[model samples]
Target: MDALDIVMNKDKAVPYYQPIISADKQEIEGYRVSGKVKGEGEKWIDLHPFFADNSIPDDYRQEIDDHIKQVAVSKYLHENRSELLFFSLNPNLVVPENIEQFIDRLSVFKSQGLPFEKMVIELKEHQFEGDVSNLKHFVQYIQSLQVKVALDDVGTSSTQLDEIALLQPDIIKVDLHAIGNSPFPSVLTEVLHSLSSLSRKIGASLLFQNIQEFTHLNYAWRHGARYYQGSYLSKESLTFLDKKSFTQALNKDFHRFLSFEKKKIKSQIALTDTLTKRLKNYLNNNKDFSDIDQVTKEIASVLSDYSFRVYICNEEGIQQSGNALKDEKGVWQYRVEERYRNWSWRPYFLENIVRLQYEQKGMLSDLYTDIHREERIRTYSYPLNDQLYVFADIPYSYLYEKDFLL
Candidate 1:
């Protein structure tokens, strides 16, 4: 079918269902409903716009005039939603001019009892190109309705992250493009797995799609995918019943995932405790210190990647020099503490550190901008046996160079 043929014909576009499974499988999580259209002698659905862009019919942009048809489509999905599972449809399929109309339709859905919550509207990664600010407002408005949003085809391009943060999607679907060759057997497992921790931090759920085999499903299950959709569950599958089956599978998968997650948290806590105690025992040896120098050496070595100079601010905001390194030997230069009121750091850490150091004696300090270095970094700090703060300068996420690069 030609591009013009699909738009003018309308009948050519059909809803193709893909199952969205929850690792917990209490019920069908949702249905990612994609539209199917025959490509020029190509059986594969033309999901993205770049395929033979030269051949696209000039008058029809995206083959779906969101400007007009969005209202009708919104009305259709809103009306037909099942309480058992969410019905996910595309938002960019709606024209920009018709966004208000779409909102109005959502209002009608709200009145009827469906609302956007049961109907997830996603935007195709390529379909969003205009003013993102306007798009954000539109998304925010939809969010106000309490309907969920998904950023379709994540990891397909660098822009996926931009849209993800801007749109604040509730779900980030892993793009099919990264799954091995568009033709070869899938082996891009490592790349797909990396996105899990990132997805978790943002409070977005990960879904692995375009998985054509059970092995791929296995990969997804092993790598933080809380949801899965593709042929292995059911080839060319499009039905509410498929949604139920997929959810059942996902529940079993997620049950195991929850167990694994708990175990990881436990292990991290145990190891952190062990490390803290060991550090304390080693530093407490009075023979090693005339002052804070011993603690400084260990901390500096642990955080050696960054060029560091430590400052201790006291109650008066004065840095006190303990003559810390006067006779202290090797590698202790990285940590030189002239005493400032050391308590300020702990109070600041207690008040500011997001994920680490909540009553834990030894943990990374909340990130603070290093006035000296003019960069953001966190100090891994623990109260030393001498009652002074022992801090190690470590770069964090904002300093991406420390992570993937170093």
Candidate 2:
């Protein structure tokens, strides 16, 4: 027999609640409904794996989805009606005819003082198949009932911005699993920033899901995640925690995170100030730094302890000097390359150059991945003269120690 048949025969489907906490408010704002089924030896089977198996029929999958939603909402209406209830449904399982059935079940709760606005129906971004415009219609129809729509598992390689724009969900829940394992942190940060900006434009709030560590929380906060959830903060349970206890531990952790970030910012400011002054003095001492070899030697001596690389470009972005890469042994090596290759096309390259033209001081760039090195780095550009500019690349490690360097 199929798993769904077994589930229905045994009446084993049940809902588990995972709390979603507000990072800014430090309170439990809502709970995501997950599913479990009774198994041998008192073990519970997670419904995710079962739902993922393609061998299951569409009707059977919908049954399981409906069961979980019904149980979650019923329990919420009877026991707790204060916080929001997030219910996820697979797009493939969503039938146009079933909308009324789902609404009828939820209307029962509405009659019992459970507000329809508190019900957030999450649609997985990665699971949606076929025409997106159809999904948009479905989402709009659902929203017409005064229920909010949430886009789930966002901020992945498969995230479709055009579809998201068209759907314009009320909330975007970014999955943090891939972000923690991602090798390209700078690119990830940029992607998150883009998602955050789009959320604001579309009037959608950003929620970071699967946040399992302090580092994940740090990234979410920096990238504009207002709501957060994961095993790190709290695990899924059959019963909900009281609002008082939920906020107490969460508030303590939030304060600690803020304190740590404040100290890190102070240290970064001090370090950058010292390095900028030393660079200014070095450049002033050797006003006629025409020779690339001598200029690199002088700068390398000052920045050797900290990780650094240096290169020079003309006003038009043609490489005028070779690369000065700092080795692990604190030794500097200059590599020759062809001139006239332009860096003007790079992001923020021209912006920093324009700033240097006006300020005439060293300009620091926002954190980014170096195309050549494939490492997180920040470039500091200084105008050596009206026609020449020196670019110093600082590895992310020595810059902020992974403390949200924007």
Residue-level lDDT of model 1, residues 188-262, one tens digit each, is 433454467667777888887777765566667767777777776765443445335555655565576667657
Question: Highest lDDT: which candidate?
Answer: 2
lDDT of 2: 0.78
TM-score of each: 0.55, 0.80
Worst 10 residues of 1 by lDDT: 321-330
TM-score computed on alpha carbons, candidate 1: 0.55
CA RMSD of each candidate after superposition? 8.8, 4.1
Clash totals for all candidate models: 15, 0
